[model samples]
Target chain A: MQVAKTVKDINNWVRHTKESGRSIGLVPTMGFLHEGHLSLVEAAKAENDLVVMSIFVNPAQFGPNEDFERYPRDFERDSQLAEKAGVDMIFAPSAEEMYPRESPITMGAGTLANVLCGKSRPGHFDGVLKVVTKLFHLVQPDSAYFGQKDAQQLAIVESLVQDFNFPLRICRVDTVREQDGLAKSSRNVYLSETERAEAPKLYQALQQGAAAAREGKDPVPEMARLIQSETSGTIDYIELLSYPDLNEAPDGQAILALAVQFQKARLIDNIIFTLKEN
Target chain B: MQVAKTVKDINNWVRHTKESGRSIGLVPTMGFLHEGHLSLVEAAKAENDLVVMSIFVNPAQFGPNEDFERYPRDFERDSQLAEKAGVDMIFAPSAEEMYPRESPITMGAGTLANVLCGKSRPGHFDGVLKVVTKLFHLVQPDSAYFGQKDAQQLAIVESLVQDFNFPLRICRVDTVREQDGLAKSSRNVYLSETERAEAPKLYQALQQGAAAAREGKDPVPEMARLIQSETSGTIDYIELLSYPDLNEAPDGQAILALAVQFQKARLIDNIIFTLKEN
Candidate 1:
């Protein structure tokens, strides 16, 4: 597989692919790949003639106090996995290469970006949308793959694509998970041995919430209590809201999400379940 | 030439052209086409296999107090002008069609958008960049055209293209002017008989500034004074700054820009020139 480390290289490679009449697909990711990212790559490979996986650990998406500096990255390991997953090209740009100058223009994701994770980490999704938009422009892909693990991120990206009229389809892959039910995340590596043991409780609580909502019971309170009782971690938030919109989840299929801090790691997980129609 | 009033029609048309191995160029304008807008279409025709002209008088770019409602638009005239200038397609989406939902995401142009005309018309460049970015995405042109008459606007769009890594070229056509030197603008129709006669002085003052700068003299003060002395209109501003950046122009080259108010019409003009290296 070809590896591109600069904007010019990727643009040339993608353009050449277009000129040759092959459909291009992009799976944008930060490195330290796991099954979740690999799942996106798999989906991309399934649909397109060529798949380009971007492995840039974007610092713009991380806030000043967030773990931007400590974000894990292993290029050698990621390259091997991408090749194994049938990626045609791996575009791994350095921070300096991705952002040559201080960005003079930025996207402000309005109302949708102001809820859930956005409340805790302000400007995070805006940063994500900006980089995603840049990658979309550079790749000019026929389709782009994103993981449903980062559901809010995926939804915001879909909004950006639709609102801006980007000529591409967003294919969402289901969240990849550990056998015990912990959603696979790069930050999962940061969990202490004890924290790792407790991580599955986050997703378990989400399933419980979904089950409760399906059974005609209010899920927010029970879900919040379940996380507090089952895990030794500190609860950040346990929200039951409409999928994608994150508004109050009315009487229908909605998302129940939670973020919990376990020592050095913050783990997030969610589940979607339906209630009787209103 | 085909005229499309919906997004789907234009996207399908552009996609067909791409599939047939032809390059598409875009000339985005706010209708009421003149020689200036036609020059952009002419430039687009010169470089690409097909040219798509977008006639959207974007309300997002106008302030509540601005002339958005009164902005002159004549589709019959514009269609004839575009066809005569060799445009292949005209995408004229209505405001409702263009903005199906109030935009959830918008571009904030940061420092570059808050100066010069941006200062007087807050959120103006933001609206322009948003719509321009949308057109760029929908049209998916190989190249896009803009007139140097709106120099600041041109620079901002170029910045958007580069910063976002858009897969297209920005072809900046030189400002088209009348014999007496008034830059061609659709807003020219707003001028009264006397205002129309006096408008050329705006360009004259810019030339005077360029000449003085070339002769090793400070141009801002004299340029401001010249506009006041030569025109009966009120001088809103007469400043000299660096091209594209709009920062303080050094000894090598600079842009002289101005805004003048004549009864109902507000006219703006600028000239770019170089001096001996400092």
Candidate 2:
């Protein structure tokens, strides 16, 4: 596996792959890899001739009050994980390299971007769109992989791809989880030992909500209340919305999302269930 | 030339070309081809193996009060013109087809977009980005062409490709001017006889500004005075800023932009110059 830290190196490497007729795949992540990110890499490797994983702990996606600086990153560990997962290249760019200038153009906001994560961290997705877009340009991938762990981001990216005609396919991998059911995330490192113990409750709440909806319950509102009841961890929001369109999850299409603050570290996770037809 | 009005048709066409190892070039425009557009097609033909033109008068780029309804379009004439210019495919999607479901994810705004057309027409750049991105996605061109007549737009699209890693080279064809010196635009159809008679002065003033800059005259004030003094039509703005990153162009790397009111129609144009260093 090749590791490139500079944008030029990554661009040249990806272009070489393209010219050589290799179908490139990209898995963009704010690094500190876990099973979730590895799952995406594995999915990319299965579908693409080459897979490029970007390890960027993007600061823009975090608000001034949020933990941008404290975000965990271990390049050596991530590189090993990616290589083991069959990634062909790892692009780790400095903040300056990824965003040399402020974005002059703006992607129109995703509707759900305003609902959960967007509600708590405004301009977060704007930052996400910008960096993801820059990476898409760099990788020139035939397909890009993203984890369903970040369901809203998955939807927004799908929207970006479909709307823009990005000349690439976006493949979504299912959420990867811990043995106890906590969805894997780089931010999971922030959980204190006690908060870590309570983290599984967030996933449990999501599952209960999904189960309720699965067993003939009205998913949206009931799921919301169950999430709100399960954790007193300053609920950012718990929504049940469409997994992909993020529109009102037509009785047949919806996912349960949860965000809770545990010991000052905000942990977000969601579980998508196939709902019965309206 | 084959014409594909649907995204699926164009996507298939581009895929077929790719199967044979040919590169596709895209020139996106709202139908009503003029010399300016033809020059873009000429640049694409000269550079790429296959050329695709998208005729979409994107409504998203127009302000509420702008002329979307009256935007001049003649599909038959445009198809003939593209064929004459050696265009291999014309992708003319209807507004409904182009915008299915009001585009959930849109391309973002970059530097040039916020200033000129962006200020005059709120959400104009958003619309440009939406359609341009969609065209890029569907056409999968190796290179895309735009006229320097819309210098700021050319800059924005270039930024999008660079920022998004769209896997295409961007070529800026020089502005195509008429014998009387007006920059070619499909909106030229909006001009009545008197307006047509007055339009040439807009470009004349722009030239005067360029000449002043090239001759080492203080470009800012001279450009302002020249543009304000020479035109009978209502003027919106005229100013020259040193080109970005190439800051303080002693030899004048600059962009000259203007908007003029001719009757009820507002027309805009710009020219970017790279002065040979003294």
Number of the top TM-score candidate: 1
Chain A TM-score by candidate, in order: 0.96, 0.92
Worst 10 residues of 2 chain A by lDDT: A223-232
* lDDT tens per residue, model 1, A1-278: 99999998998898899889999999999989999988898888889999999988888899999998889978999999999999999988888887888877889888877666888999998899889998998888999998887878987888888889999999988999999999999999988887898788888878877877777787778777877887788888877777766677565658777788888898888776676675
Docking quality category of candidate 1 according to DockQ thresholds: high
Cα TM-score per model: 0.97, 0.89
Candidate 2 CA-lDDT value: 0.77
Look at candidate 1 and tell me the lDDT of residue A162.
88
Two-chain complex of model 1, DockQ on C-alpha atoms against the true structure: 0.84
Any idea how many clashes model 1 has? Answer: 0
The digit string of per-residue lDDT tens for model 2 on A1-278 reads: 99999988987897677667778889998778888888888888888888889888888788998888887878888898888888888899898887776655676566757776888888888778877777787787888888888888888888877766677888879888899998887777777776787678788778777887778675556655654565546677777777677766446667778778777678889887788775
| Residue runs of model 1 more than 4 Å from their true location after superposition | A249-251, B249-251
